[model samples]
Target: MQHKNTIKLLFLAGITMLLASCANDDDTAFTPMEFTTPTYETNLELLLGDTLKLNQEILNLPENVQFKWTTEDTVLSILQNLEYIPKQAKTFALTFKATTNLDSISRTYQVKVNDPYDVYYRPKSSESSSLISQVLAYNPAPGQFINSSFGTPEDAQKLVGSTTNTISLGAWGGSILVGFDHTIENVADAKDFLVYGNAFNGLSEPGIVQVSFDTNGNGLADDTFYELRGSAHADAATLTNYTTTYTNPGMHADVPWLDSLNTAGSVVVNSYHPQNFYPLFITELEEVSYTGTRVFPVVSNSGFTNIAALEWGYVDNYDADYATYKGNLLDIDQAIDADGNSVNLRGIDFIRIYTGAQVNAGALGELSTEIRGIADFSMLE
Candidate 1:
């Protein structure tokens, strides 16, 4: 009787072990919840006021899972899909979460909303001239002609109606803003505009050109400006968002300037230009600041210092006589945004030109850009 009781105990112990092994196998076979999508990051882009649908198909999640989408403190959607329309141009960070009883998964999306396309058609009137009709703004950095010849806002107006008149944009960052009565179309496979400057064979003071559209129909150049990508634009030496501040020395002296790179320099005073280098028209502020793209100039000193011209895409940059129509021709298709990405602009209503170099050529003084006039190329065609 004792042996039978022992045998029964052993059998019961074996059965219990078998049941535990089966339970372990079941747990091992269970699959963990995970996103089946190939990539974890998603990017969506749309224009402002346009509906962007975020369908559940993008998740590739399993059925019976709960979904939640949130941006900041606001819950965008609790459903499996979302339809969003942005009111303004900005970026939005969105989070999508899927949860079940035992597992959860999440994803992030960056939604970039851009402004709607606004194109200003050219006017049909025969009286409209291809040249710029108005001077919107002018600000010249400290240079030889700041207070003497071409620093004031009124000096920018001289180039409006005639190709013979000229204005000097003082040393680096000096800029002029001008607008046309009609928009200049970006014709395919052809240059769109011409900018006349005093650039000749051995003297080239290139100016960075930027274009803007009247997106709001406000008849103002208050919209975003895109830089025209020049030959040096892709060069690693080129600097973007460069800033220089000029401090008034209170006399006709070397204009001291500090740059964003923590470097310091001066717009050396020359005997030919005895007037103050600092702009005198700006009385409200003692110091002036200017910022834009800066290019590297190749300065060679033989008998005289000569600044070499870039291949193309800059005002006051030398070009072959046949390639120019009394000025340097520019293509509107080369427009680029702040991030160095190319942008397709239908047309432009305003143009801004700024001195792009900051070299002080020994006795020649500071390098400056001189603009005679700007004209729409379609008129010539």
Candidate 2:
């Protein structure tokens, strides 16, 4: 009986020791797993001409780790080697994403760039409601078929100038020089100014618009002028470097014009607008000459044939309608040197628009390209 009690006591002690070992195993298994990801700064400030360097070192990321960087500003020029350079003054938002075997993380950075040139001139606030501040000159000659009143010199301001209200232009090569109270800056990577004209369904009257900078700082418009070439300037149907001469019809005769192709057309007298299309500024001139790009006018059995709206880059396009007008946006980058190479311009002070097409729409009379108003493109945005 003594020996049996001794064996049972030893077995109970062994069982206690086994339970304690199982408890130790449970405590060791309960430890949680941990995860980690890379991080970086979330804000940055830059100047107009400064460059931002992007690399794993700046991010304090581990070596051999791959990451991606991107920005929302189109004006920024990104180098293939990983540099962010802003071309203009604006706030840019950048995103950086990094991933690892265990997890991934993302961060955003706000970059504000300051403009060195600052705001030289503020555009008129009321683009659609504002009238052209000034009209410097008006020149229109009568067409053999197109005879209408160009109004007086005072009336000329209302004649080819831009307005939110309805206005008319003397048919033929009626040209006008319009000015603004402030200069128009050449915005980077964006359109500078917009040309508002009268374009209806299937009928588009194109005009040649030119720009000039106050380079001489003379406040006057005697500076060099650059033509804002339109979309049709390069069309195979267009006549580039073309020249045409118009001889005055005198007091009561038809106007005649001759083109480079020797294809002659007459401006016939129509009963539409009673005012003579000839300019009151110039008279009894032997001949008037026009040299530049010309857009072809369409005439069909149903009336004027529809001129397809260009993708962009032309004034008086189909977008000129009152309901859809968004200023015909033009970029200063489109300017070209006399050799046809691109020319860089800082800003413009004066604007000139001329009747670009020598087209007659039969009963419609001469295609009188009309202007409603001009506005800085930024105003629409």
Candidate 3:
């Protein structure tokens, strides 16, 4: 009986020790794998091309925990090191998974990518698209340049529904100031807007486009201007920081234009538009000065050269020459000051396009850049 009692006590002690060991294991094992998110916010809004850095330490996960990042859409590209780059302009949901040997937790991040630019205004200019009624509807604003020669200066708005009466930027400095109802945000990989001009055949009258932003919010186009440097901006022959002045000779007299290069040219009398292609709206000013880059026309043995079509980032070039060009589409990111310094513009509210080249298209007299309409690419997409 004694031996049996001793054996029973040994068994009980063994059971008690086993229970204590199990309790100790429960206390030291993994603290139920609780996770506390960091105080920093995860949701963010960023412009396209901006870098996005995520803080992995905020997950409050274990030291050995592994992170897996994924995006719901292809708009954002995620790197293995938790950095991200936006590829498109749109809102996206990004998910981060924090996983350990036994527990896992996930957090979704809301990211908004703003669209670059929207079609703000399309001025009534000469367009050769053969679709007048359809093109007029794309006109964004009612404000048009007035000409007293047509009728009452105020009544003489841009020819609505009429393709014959196109706005003429006569010579070297002839320009039309176009504005956007809203500012156009600059985004990465975005082509911003298009300048639809009546360019065809051997006539690719290129224009130097300029942009401005509404800085003071007073809603006027009196802000500083930046030139939209085209592919020719870096060429040795291209002129930077150029200026031209056009002086009216009145009625039948030709408008005399002189450039900074001392090259004298006249807004000659073209027989096609005998009514005077020089804009008759602003009769108050005898002379006007325009400052911007000068784009030379394609030179050939015949004096008129058909330049190769740029893939993108230009307007009114020989588009039909190459299969790549759809029209004169321009990107806002290509903006630069007169000194060839890049302007980091977030958005722009106004655009001005002027007749850039001073070439004589044989019977056409002096080649003038003619704009038909403008469209924002973001809206089309």
Best by lDDT: 1
Worst 10 residues of 1 by lDDT: 116-125
For candidate 3, what is the lDDT?
A: 0.58
lDDT of 1 by residue, 82-144 (tens): 887777678889888778776677788999887755334555368878898999888878788
Model 3 Cα lDDT, one tens digit per residue, 148-196: 2222222213433333444545455556666544456565777777666
**lDDT by residue for model 2 (196-278), tens:** 77676666666677788665455677867788766667778976677667776555445677877787876666655544444
Candidate 1 residue pairs that clash: none
Worst 10 residues of 2 by lDDT: 29-38
lDDT of each: 0.83, 0.62, 0.58
Q: Candidate 1's C-alpha lDDT? A: 0.83
Cα RMSD of predicted structure 2: 17.7
Where does candidate 1 stray beyond 4 Å?
Answer: 1-119, 321-323
Task: Rank the candidate models, highest TM-score first.
Answer: 1, 2, 3
Instruction: Name the TM-score of candidate 3.
Output: 0.54
Arranged by lDDT, best first: 1, 2, 3
